[model samples]
Target chain A: MKQSTKYMMSDGLAFSEKRDLKRLQKKSKEGWHLFSFLPMGYNLQKGEPKELQYSVDYRHLQDGEDQEYFELFEMAGWNHVCSEVGIHFFVAPMGTQPIYTDVESQIDKVQRLSKNVYMTAVFFVLMTVVSYFVSELTTGIVSSIFHYILLASEVFTIPCLMMVASLLYRKWVKKS
Target chain B: MKSLEQLTDSVFYIMAALVQPKHGYAVMALVEKETGGEFTIGPATLYTIIKKLLNENLIFLHDESNPRRKVYALTEKGHHILVKDIERRKTMLSLAERELRGGNAE
Candidate 1:
């Protein structure tokens, strides 16, 4: 099969899922359909143009219930697409019923996604601190190759913290 | 004896739609028809609500024979909550009407 793939970066956070959905829909209209989801992005295959409505659900599939969950959504008029970790993607024709029907459920989905991201951010921060202490104890306070690696890790931690902070602000500070 | 705290429009309509056993797409169709195009329940919302309702025993799977399309029906508990909610709304509407008439008399 002749196929072309497009890699687009995405924030694996709940708040940004809607943006990703919109992007997928737009790409689909241009004959680029989503083939699979990749880490931090999506892989789309070039194909006949489609006007498909895209939505992503953030839910952890339980043991032995994966088929049931997909069947339920499929029965609801959504065609299941690829899923990555806790994120499930689906598409239906334009005007197909939306997956979320109420504000409470929608908020619940947001909270779940935020919780996952928040926990990951916390874990990263703890790892960075612990590694810094261990490196200091073994390699002395003097700068070395290990010190440079630690510096790079600390820089990466900034974005994780920022992502958590933004999610918190939206969850609590923003009324909506 | 489940007391609902302000059912969202979608939840209310969905429950009402499933007074009879219906599949997922049927519920969506009924909701849209009943609302007269005023509202439509999204698939994501419907899926989540159905799962929650099933967990709370407000709704149950009516049939599992159809692998792709599972049918659902309201449980007894769901009926009780819906009727009570209707009665509550009736009371509120009657009281509002009485207040409006009293002001008119003045």
Candidate 2:
């Protein structure tokens, strides 16, 4: 058997983490379990139908920390699914306590995610500005190169900015 | 994460449990058991708080021979902070109780 597989588009976690997790839960019930994360979406493999709840946590693990980190979640009944970048995904039976139980820690999770997003956004914004200035100051093939750079940077900068804005808004909402 | 100015319920429970030098999972189980399942700390939350406490010098690693189950215990500073938080909570409880008992009926 070639193994059944499919892809599902994500709505961008910074905008819709809750919606995405809920969708994963629904897919698990239909026997399509998430196999791994793909850029902009998920790669799912067919499996035994299950009633599971999914959650995402953001943290940078240091050397020798991953073992204890995963163990803690396992002991709490959450089975580790996969991790991409600093985002980790876990699943457990429905009604299991959520991974984040307090508002302070929940806010901290958002801040860690925001920190990563903010750095990327800053880089893209700088690229966009630098390329725009160089494209205007130079001419010929060199100008075209910077012009392309400006366009590419803008493309990335817009979404990065939106993600940062959304994350900051979430942090503010949680604080209030 | 910044040092906690006040212990949140989750942190309070974890701190109280760590007074006995327990591992991460042990802390979670103790909190759930002591609270009669009414209060519980999820694993991630417990881990985050434990790290914060460690960073703030409120807790220390009691044993790490078992890397997967490092035990933690409260530091002297941690005990002092915990005691202060308990006193603060006690004051709040007393105020609520007095009002509920019509100490200042109006």
Q: Show model 2 residue runs off by greater than 4 Å.
A: A1-3, B1-3, B104-106
TM-score of chain A of 2: 0.96
Candidate 1: segments with Cα more than 4 A from true spot: A1-3, A11-15, A63-68, A71-77, A135-156, A172-175, B1-4, B99-106
The structural similarity of chain B in model 1 to the true chain B, as TM-score, is 0.85
Best by lDDT: 2
Q: Best candidate per DockQ, number?
A: 2
| lDDT (C-alpha) at residue B30 in model 2 | 87
Summing lDDT over every window of 10 consecutive residues in candidate 2 chain B, give the lowest-scoring window. B1-10
| Tens-digit per-residue lDDT, A12-86, candidate 1 | 544476688888899999999987887678888888898998888888977755676777577667889888888
Question: What value does DockQ give for candidate 1?
Answer: 0.46
Report model 1's chain A TM-score. Answer: 0.84
Q: Can you write out model 1's per-residue Cα lDDT over B32-63, one digit (the tens) per residue?
A: 78779689877667777778788888899999
True contacts kept of each: 0.65, 0.85
